[model samples]
Target: MTAASTGDLLTTPDDLFWQEHSESITESDEELLRIVGSADLPALLAALAAATADTSFLSGDLRPPLTPVDTVGHPHGGMTPLQQERGRKVAFAALKRLRDEGITRARMLSEAETDTILEYLGNGHTEWAGMLRHELDLAPDKNGAPDWRFEDVAAGRDFTALIVGSGVAGLAAAHRFRQAGVPFAIIEATDRLGGTWQKNRYPGVRLDTPTFGYTYSFAQRTDWPQQFAEGHEIREYLETVAERSGVASLIEYGSALISAEWDGDAGAWSVTTETAAGTRQVRQFNAVITATGQLDIPNIPDFPGQASFTGTAVHSQEWDERTDWQGKRVAVIGTGASAYQIVPAICAGVERMVVFQRSAPWMLPAPAYHKPMTEVFSWLSRKVPHYAQWYRLWVTVLGIPGRFHTVRAEKDWPGAPLSVSPRNQQVRDELTRILGEQFSGHPELLKHAVPDYPPGAKRMLRDNGVWAKALTSKNVTLETSPIREITPTGIVTADGTHHEVDVIVYATGFRPSEYLEGIEIKGKEGIEIHDAWDGDARAYNGVTVPGFPNFFMVYGPNVGGVVAGSLHFMLERAGEYALKAIREVLERGIKAVDVRPEALDRFVEWVDTENRQMAWGQPYVRTWYQNSRGRVSQIWPFTNVEYWEATESLDPEDYDFLA
Candidate 1:
């Protein structure tokens, strides 16, 4: 069955087109189409008559009709099913027409008008509105960049910055520089921006985090249809941000950075870019920000006899969208985040899906996994001031903070390996209850789903419940045995059991250890970045390195959030820091500002020590968080606030400044 077009799904074409193709379509045309599509002529006339009569249907306790109500039956209070359906349709059409013409309308205000409507909607909850105002930068002193002065910097010199990659992080950095009145150019390896979002376009690929929280703080999106957005929506959002922020023109599509070297005498880094036209051009820039994220490269595990016998094999990241799996017996490796989402989505379509589970992940209940937002809820969200903002804040504090708290070890606890303390146990117990409730009739299924490791030892998966239900289905099978080799037909286990399969999807995550490994970066004294890192990636605040002067990395090593906080928040912080660093160079007449080796070392030491106290660093669980040497090097070990404070200001003493 073909999926329904996005146009048919939404009630208002104005909102739908804006959500889907805002950059492409005209707003007035979209609104006109929406009004015409929703209502009939009779309903339109009724709405006009109602408006003229000053009749109001708007109410705080408004709810959508249960089935359908007939206006003809209003005199007698009873009507046929067909009459009820037709009258309800006409009434809805009338409402749409009246709304479109702006005649006796009840609509919500935009982000700019949120403050004025706060008193009317807040109902004496001034603190909530105050917080919303502060967050949205409607209030004074809440400007995101307090340190960087655009006028002073723009007047000094025409300095240039070389930004690597055109993903969210890179796009954000470029925007920050543009806002700061700095001349910069972005070199992207691919022909498109959006980084991972642009690359990973698998059938069911979507963000685990909510869209509102995932977006940049400076650009708050008020119209997310779903709580958690899909990959296409995210990519569109990034593209919109780039175009609107004026960063789209600055990006050189199909331009890959081959190498970057610092010149002590010139006091600039020479960057080489290989364009799609097969020509190489070298440009000099005063600063560089490596915004290449961690998960760009795919990590495919080496299984024995894999090369000899294969029907069709592909990684989750490198998903072949065109590949047909209609009646094919498919084998899925790994039960991680990607696998969790992918399995359930494709289970019904495939003939047989055999999932190879290495370890079970901690699954938290998510009721909104499959539920779509009701029209009433959407209307309420738009009408209510500070409601959506407060909901987002609640999610940030309660949902995000508890994730960090679960990782910390406590002295007294019943379950040593499963939980660290009483609070941790409460989390585990809640998860257990959710699992039990989901698999009420089948205790055996619940047993298989329960994780043995402590919560947050690995990435906690949002529960779909469909995964458990799918496993219990007749066509699905879950295998825990180790695979010895892949035969011509299928996989062979260590126990000499052969499970035949037509296709295989390796959901094994990215090689995060090889951060910026492919890029050839040479600093002063002819030191390559790869050699400097020595396979153990470390950075001062996960932005700047000691050897690579004037070179910064956004979403770099140990800078990722451990809690449920958005990755965009980290990217924003890094961008803020980059702006500060660039401003200092232009103002102070400094040629290069390399991080002090001592400071970088101390920061790495602190990251390591802090991670040791978390569950990801525990000896039992094997995750992508560690390097080959078994050191925790991927995730940040502190709260989101700590990172915000650390990168909010730039201290000159942290770096070695040279004339």
Candidate 2:
């Protein structure tokens, strides 16, 4: 079918993004061999079945064969050359059928049929299949705004919301609120739209998640230069979202949320914000959603004589573009995600680079981490109905099946502590194989690089072979020795070795437990939110908090699903739940809606118990996932689907409403 035959149901391939990445197209117009070669053949068949109302593929040779669960790809994705060619011709015929029938949208599958299809998609894994069924409705064209709106319940109520921090979550919050007809204002501390993407501009910085699934489902983009987009590209995408969604006009840049005082008398939050020019303003907001992300604050270790350093010192979050590393010795203080990206990016130019490691982070092998999207896939995404959704569904399935289960500690296991379960041991073995293969010649480096703890203990960094190559370079040294102090010239190890360097890049991660760090919030009982938590952050579904009426947070406490699941998807859920709660107050004409302390307690109890079963919560492994109390305060120790289900609706019984 020509592009016009499908009509506006599919976006025309004339977008600005399409034009920019046009050079990356490898396949000709008539060729779909590339598509079929890499296709999740079952999903392709399902898509065709839904589009053409043909289920014969399910009973025929194109049926999904049960295979061992693979976390990275479809279980039955692999096909022979002959099979792929035949699938390609079948797919070509299916496109023609779409034109012949003038089909716009594909029909949804029956629940029982969907279950069977889901099991097929997941290689007979039944447990996670139930969670993915709801998401089947959440495609680009289908799931945009909520069907319910504020106007439907509170027609004339002048309810306005204040969204603090114009970041990824904030942008999505603004988009959702706008779509629901809620008048809102987005306050940004910086002059720009993208929050972390704008701030963290270190070399080799890109999204660890796949670009297709990482994007907002409502405003989906078919054209991304790389499978995992770079920082600047992500920043540009956010800015584009603001402009295209018309939320740019509602943003007040250079304004930071300082404090929010809940006024019991006024029945609203008396919010305070400070601008860049030292001007502060206090305004009343019906609802205040703090979208200040988890990784905003830079955590620089207070090593001895850090001020005595003679060279340039900067945190990865506070990266200064003017500082040059070319031909100069550099010291990367911590081996985290930023360090993983920065070391390889700058090591080649540096005269000598020393990477100080508290511990080694597990790296997932991602060969296509640096590769761009192929033209054929892009064509399929645009021309084929529900292709992008199916692709995302497949990616989500691949991530879920064995992943969440393997991370949890199996009871009474008879294996090493290096892995949580037998399945986990298998995962650990594969990862170890990757590391051993990369560091084969360098035994000393391999020993230091290999993580003693199990995989998924800490967040895994996406590897493109650059980290291995950079570490093996003659100039790069992985220092496992304890750092004693910092002198006027450089850092000193406990072994009496003073390693001098020209620059000190602190890749020391963020204070994720310190939620809403700069913001001082006082709730109904005149209690500070920070003092309430006392450094251990906990929230109901990572959104609402007890005693804090009409307050919500995005990317908040214990929402850390570091193993699997997409962060953007979590952000969407959190936003939706928070909006739903806000709608309850405005619609019901209630003064406020505050989460019961018992609800928060139950959530914390569940999370803590589940965390005890996960790798991150182990006493042997310690990372930013825990706080000073040694509690897993950052990660929401549950399946991402569970969080999605919990936030699907706002329960009235969970909260107290003040009419």
Candidate 3:
């Protein structure tokens, strides 16, 4: 499908909205076409109000509606039918005037007008107004113009910098560096880009979050083929972002970083690299950014006798598309997110499938998880300027801060092991109801599927009834027995039951707590970063370290899988902060800037303290969020908005400047 041009509304357009999975127009497309095609104010207001209703329970719209309408991919304020009618009239008149006058930019609206519109869209609340401004790049400049572009503030000074990995975070870093006129090189271990997206090639691989929230705020897309996009589409989007941001040329593909040694005297890092051709080279840079994200490394467990019995063993991260699973017996180890997605895609083809579950993950309801984006809605976004941005803001509001209340541990709440607070209990009940409904026919399977731990204790899986359907298949078996060992033929359970399979697929997640492992990073006084971490990795604000001077980690420890917001938003802010720190060094003539040890200690303490108050810190919960030492190090304890504010500006008091 091609992108729709500025003129064409009915004809199929290209670029962002094209879905490779389906070409047929949907009912949603027809509905959206009808809404945008006509110029009738009353009808438009009705359609607009109906389209933006609070179906997702997002936007904090608790008010009773006059009538419920399908509000897929739209934002609505919480209001009674009378209030909605009044609101529709006001919003319609304002929006119509803007459209007629060609006022597309945020600068066109006065501060009061902007606030009014933001408050209206935000469900009569001022909470998300600041976030909307920052996220949409509508923050005003000194001259009252909405300008989000960072100026080259390095005072004409130039320095060499090296970025490891060309993943989402690294690409973002490269973009920031290019914008700031910094000469930099991005070294990606693999031949291609998109890091995890490029590697995980299993069928039906897609994001849990909405596509609107997943995209880079700076580079928004109008055409997302689905509410939740597949892996290839996201990768393609990133590649497009790289090209458009002028960072495509700055990337050094196939060059993997081997080591980075800081020379205190020279005030530079001697970075070593190895190519696919066995060529090793050392390059010097003023600073090194380790954007080699947490999820890059696959955590492969050594199953006993696994080497002997393996017909074909593969980690989900290292999925080989060439492997034929047609009519083959498959043993899926670990029922995590990967397994949840992988099972439904391959269950129908496999002769017999066995899913070994250590713990049943809590599968949350996501109705539109499998639904595709309609062409008409895509066309509406493209035809109307600022429409896509507004939609994205709606997504951001829904995801970023909407669920923050659920994760926080309410000390006085009645629910304990099953849930933390009343709100969390409500969520658990909803999720349990959905799971139960999915497996209502199979009572035994449903029993094994329900998790014992409290909801939000681990990573939540998005369910569209596919996982339960796959498990209930006659050819599939969900094994809850503990595996004692792997035999030559198959897996040996503690009960001495043997389940034979042709292929062993490990759906085990990544070693997220082990931040920047394998790479030797030696700082001042030969202080190794790993040694400083001492099996418990900690970084100030999850980016900077005390011992590691002139080094910044993007998508680093405690920040990757944040529950509050999209990873893209976190990484973008992180990349921006890293660039700011880099600029500070060049502008101030500082050789190195190290986060003060005290500051680092305080940050770590704060993270620990905050973690104890969250679900991830529940003593009974065993998740990837915790390290071997049982410390929660992978997730950010605070909301995304808090992290954004903290990283928005730099504080010199927190760091020690060295000449």
Candidate 2, residues 1-659, lDDT tens digits: the string is 44323322323321212211112223443555556556556567656665565555454354444333423543356544555567667776776566455554644455555665666566565775545654564222233356678778889887788999888999988888988888888999999888899999998899888887677655566567889999998998988988888888889999988999998878888999999999999999988999999898999888989898889999998999888889999999898899998999999999999999988888877888889887656666665666666676666665553366767887766664688888878888888888899999999999888888888888888887888899999999989888999998999998888999999999999988888887899998899999998988889999999999999998998886776676777887888888888878877888889999899899889989989998777777777889989999888766666876788788888999987
Candidate 1, pairs of clashing residues = none
2 or 3, which is superior by lDDT?
A: 2
Go through the candidates in order and give each one's C-alpha lDDT.
0.67, 0.77, 0.72
Give candidate 3 regions above 4 Å deviation. Answer: 1-77, 87-112, 123-130, 137-158, 412-414
**Model 1: per-residue lDDT, tens digit, 1-659?**
11111112222211111222111112254453444343222222222222322223211122112111110012112224454445455445444443444332222223333443332223223444533332432233343543455567557565788889889899878877777777788888888889999988766787776566677655556567776788888899888888877788888898888889998898889988887788899889988888889987888778888987658888887788887777899999989888888888888899998999878777766657665554543442343222344344433432233356566776544577777666567777878887788778877667877888777778877676777877777788888888999988899888888999998999888888788866789998999998888878888888998878889989888987755466776787787787788777777777878889998889899989889888777666677899887888889887665676678668778987888
- Candidate 1, after superposition: displacement of residue 43 in Å? 35
Provide the global lDDT of candidate 1 against the true structure.
0.67
Deviation in Å, model 3, residue 438 alpha carbon: 1.5
Error of 3 at 106 (Å): 8.1
Query: 171, model 2: CA deviation in Å?
Result: 0.8
Q: What would the TM-scores of all predictions be?
A: 0.78, 0.89, 0.86
| Model 2 clashing-pair count | 1
Best prediction by lDDT: 2
lDDT of 3 by residue, 296-388 (tens): 788878767877985888999899999878999999999988898999999999999999999999876678798987654564454434455
